[model samples]
Target: MSLLEQLNQDMKQAMKNKEKDKLAVIRMVKAALQNEAIKSSHAELSNEEELTVLSRELKQRKDSLLEFKNADRLDLVEKTQAEIDILVDYMPEQLSEEEVSEIVKQTILDVNATSKADMGKVMGALMPKVKGKADGSLVNKLVLQQLS
Candidate 1:
């Protein structure tokens, strides 16, 4: 099933199961997807577009988790972590750091990137290959490490 269809089915199941937290997250994702469609003037989002939305949601949750941790708010941290877990369920399987490093290394070769000056070139060529599979920040770090 497509991600949107799966989300709709899960939303119903959440309501039936009285899973308040899960239901809320599902609704939020649905809203984001709908908003994206409206913004792009598209009737429906492709799976790739849905994945982009999912990744954005996941990034937001992770940022919140970090802030909560810094504030020593255990309750908020736990809740944010739960939200992150829910978002992750819909994401494509993430690449390991080693796998990302390998791809970055190859992309560097493909783009003939040398030194930190070519970071942009490397990233431009690499992001599409790794999108939805690896986090951008992680890829950036790997690229920097490989280039330096």
Candidate 2:
């Protein structure tokens, strides 16, 4: 089944099981996907567009988790993290650090990125390949580390 189809199935199961946290996260994802379809005036979103929206939602949760942690609110941190976990079930499995490093190295070569000045070139070429599998800030840091 497509990711969206799987998400829909899971949403129904969550409701049947009375899984409040899981249901909440699933509802948020459903709303986001619906919003995207409406915004683009498309009858259905492409797989790439679905992945993009999923990644953005996951990223937002990660940011909130970090903020909650920094504020020493363990309760919110745990809650936000649970939501992140639920969202991740719909994402492609993440690439390992070694795989990410290897790709970043090749991207730098392909883009002829010599310094931080060429960071944009490297990132532009890399993000498409890395999207939904790698953290953007981590990728940016690795690119800068390589360029420097």
Error of 1 at 79 (Å): 0.6
The sequence of per-residue lDDT tens digits that candidate 2 reaches over residues 27-70 is 89889999999999998999999999999999999999989989
Off by over 4 Å in 1: none
Candidate 2, pairs of clashing residues: none
75: Cα error in model 1, Å: 1.1
Which lDDT values do the candidates have, in the order given? 0.94, 0.91
Model 1, residue 1: distance off in Å is 1.5
Question: Tens-digit lDDT track for model 1 on 86-112?
Answer: 999999899999999999999999989
Q: Specify the highest-lDDT model's number.
A: 1
